[model samples]
Target: MSALVDMNAKSGNLERALKLFEEMPKRVYRLSKFSGCSIATLLKVCKTTEHLHHLHARIIRKGLEQDQFLIAEFITLSNSLASLNYSSSVFDRVISPNIFLWNSLIRGYCQKRCFQDVLSVFIRLKRQACLPDNYTFPSLIKACSSLCNVEGGKSIHGSVVRHGFEACVFVGTSLIDMYGKCGHIDDARKVFDEMTERNVVSWTAMVVGYVTVGDVVEAKKLFDAMPQRNVASWNAMIQGFVKLGDLSSARGIFDSMPEKNVVSFTTMIDGYAKSGDMVSARFLFDQSLDKDLVAWSALISGYVQNGQPNAALNFFLEMESMNVKPDEFILVSLMSACSQLGSLELAQWIDSYVSKSSINIQQDHVIAALVDMNAKSGNMERALKWFEEMPKRDLVSYCSMIQGLSIHGQGAEAIRLFNRMLTEGLVPDEVAFTIILTACSHAGLVDEGWHYFRSMKHKFCISPSPDHYACMVDLLSRSGHVKAAHDLIKSMPVEPHAGAWGALLGACKLYSDSDLAEIVANRLFELEPRNAANYVLLSNIYAAAERWIDVSLVRNKMRERGVRKIPGCSQI
Candidate 1:
């Protein structure tokens, strides 16, 4: 019976193994090594943490606690579940752990991104006189890199040398990665230079290190010097060029490659998308015989980002037809397009698809994204419904709803929501403050706008940006305090932006001031020479002031500068 259970467990048939164990006589596990080992193996395949705990207790009660091999398996299983505390408990119960067992526990901590825990294990490993092997150093050094502890990394490096594993290839690559990520490219390069041998991975890590430091020139030099190259090495170099906004150089490498992988194509597509050349992006995407989720997402996002919502929708439809399942990224991109178009039908469809799928409904950003989509698409009622329906509303959700309210002339409600955010202990970020201030400007609440502007710096410690100043100027100018707005712009500690000047100039137009209009127009002409609206506005101000000669001069200046007013339409 025990043999059959072990066989079932080994084959990943945990149900069959458990059934056989349940049917076995009492004290069977205590008397047989096969029973304990089989249950331990079942824990490896089992998904439930509760079941594992039950089996763990059984293992201890059965007096198999001294079985280091079975205990190591339990630690490995617990680690995979991200149950580090459980793994540690199992590790502690073991009388004395072997080197493999120690590595297993450390590996668990590394997987959980608990770098400090991994470091603590290394210290314990040393005190216990169990010297770290090649398997141990790689995980430890990686944790050091993740933590960016250069000093800790150096101590581990000395330990690696003392343990005679310095020449280990895998360990060498890890050291290079550790030092590189720690921002010590010099140390990384020195390690790379001293290496007895180098693989493509080692070469790639070094190149990536140089890229991280923004020394793409040196990275390219290293790339050229490599004896052999893999696709990753090529991708690393290409990404380096793209990072520096050198698309031409990145394309040159892309074309030179003998073989192009998905990542290679995706990188080039992303570059073209960012550069506003959607033509190249689509051309490459269509040419691909195999389009993965990432490739599809890159093209879809490119269209959305470049302001082609219809094109983004078309690609998403094509992706759906291909039976290519969309992840959260693609869903977000689709939602962004839907939000821009304000298509309630399409928004409902996305919501339905999300509901039908097993995607985590608890994901805060996804839920907030849906709200943003509805708000932007001119469906505030539906947006509010979704916002209320959300079980876990994050700060973004609050800000989006507030901005939406302000857009629909519910300024008082937006202020109330902002208060609610503070009451909930949610700190407003720069973007949130910008929205709230814009809301005040839209609602013509000059005093309220001023109060919040002061509060942003004094209470929240967030200094007002140019956008905030622009909002204040807009608020003051809109409330018939045009001269006061102009004075405020002049008194600004930071250099007033074109928006500030534009707001003031707009107020000049509101009050029909020929002299102030002339002053503001010249500044606009210097700041935005191509903006024909400024010239037209100045001409209008001259005409409003009954200065025919000045109006003609402004028109002649506009023609000389090749500036033409944007076409306007009249409602019948």
Candidate 2:
């Protein structure tokens, strides 16, 4: 009967194996005498959480709960099935866990990105005097790297050296990656230099370390010096140059590569798109044979970035026609294009498609884009519904919703939401502050604007940036406090930007203060001589006061500077 269970389990017929195992005790078979291999096989074939618990109960009944191998495999399988809590519970049942059990728990936590938990488990492992082996440090160091906890990584490195595992290439490679990711490239280099044995991964880690710190020059030198290079190493070098906006250099390397994968093609496409060289981006995109979702996303994102929303949408259609599924990333890019175009028809189609296709629109990024798109398309009701229904409102979602409210001139409501975000313990960043300040300016909330502005510097310790100052200037100017706005601009610690002057000049036109307008316009003319709007604005201010001569003079100056007023057009 035990052999039958083993054969059935090994053959992947878990249902049959489970039935036989359950009938064993009812048929007077000795459960205690069941072979460990058969039991291990049964555990391997177990699919659902219910079955796992049932087997665990049987193991406990048979007094095999403490079987180290069985418990270790149980813990591992539980984690693999996304049951970290269950894995932890099983580990807790072991009265005397060996190093293997401790390592298993640590690895599970690391896989789940529970970095602090990994560290906590390591501390417990030490308290129990369970010696960690080479398998332990890689995951443990990776947790530190993911957290960017250099101090924690350094402590782990000390442990690795103490355990005499530094010479192990795998441990050394992890240490190098940790130091590199933590912005300690020099320390990473030190680890790389000390390693007596190095493999492709070790060298790749060092190469990537240089790339992360924006040292592409040094990275290239190392790349050239490598005894051999893999596709990842090549990709890293290209990515470095692309980030630096050295597309020509990136292309040179791309053309030189003996092999080019999808990542290689996608990286170049992204670079060209960002540089506004959409033509070249499409050329490389077409050159790639393997067009995965990532590659398609790259092209679509590039079109969006290049202000070609229609092109992006058409490509999305092409993707669908090819039977390629769209993920959250592509959806976000498409939504951004819709936001820019403000096409209600397009927005509705996308919303309906997402619903019918069963895409997970509730993902934070996707929902954030949806909120922004709906608001931009003049569908505030749906936008607000989506915002309110979010299972978790992260900072990005809050910012998007707040910006949408600001766009609709619902300043008071935006402020309320901002306060709600504060109550939720989401510390507002600089961008959040800028949005709220702009919201206050638009609503003409003078007192509230002053309060948040001072709070930014005093309470939040966030220094008021130029954008914040510009918001305040516009707020004061709109409230008929032109002199106060001018005084604030003069008192600015940083050099006053054109936005501050522009706001005051616009206010001058409202109040018909020709002298102040002339002064602000002259300053702007000096700062932004090629800005036709400044000249046109000054001309309007002079013309308002019936100063035709000055208007003519402004026009003459524009003619002299050869500045042409660029006509504005609306996008449907």
Question: Which candidate wins on lDDT?
Answer: 2
Q: What would the TM-scores of all predictions be? A: 0.82, 0.78
Error of 1 at 196 (Å): 2.5
Provide the global lDDT of candidate 2 against the true structure: 0.89
* Model 2 TM-score, all chains together: 0.78
Q: How far is candidate 1 from the true structure (C-alpha RMSD, Å)?
A: 4.4
Each candidate: what lDDT?
A: 0.86, 0.89
Worst 10 residues of 2 by lDDT: 26-35
Q: Report the C-alpha lDDT of model 1 over 1-572, residue by residue, as the tens digit.
A: 87887788778777787778778887676565767666766776777777677677777667788787777788888887647887898898787789989998999999899999899999999999987899999999999999999999999999999989988989999999988877899999999999898898999999999988889999999999999999998998899898899999999999999888988988888888888899998898887776788888888888888899999999888888988889888888889888778787888887788778767756777788888987766678878888998997778899889888888788988888898889989999889989999899899987788888899999999988888889988999888898888788778889887898888888888987778778878888999999887888888888888999999998999889888888999998
Poorly placed runs, candidate 1 (over 4 Å): 1-90, 342-356, 385-398, 422-433, 453-466, 489-530, 541-553, 556-562, 569-572
| TM-score, prediction 1 | 0.82
- Positional deviation of residue 514's Cα in model 2 after best superposition, in angstroms: 6.9
The total of clashing pairs for model 2 equals 0
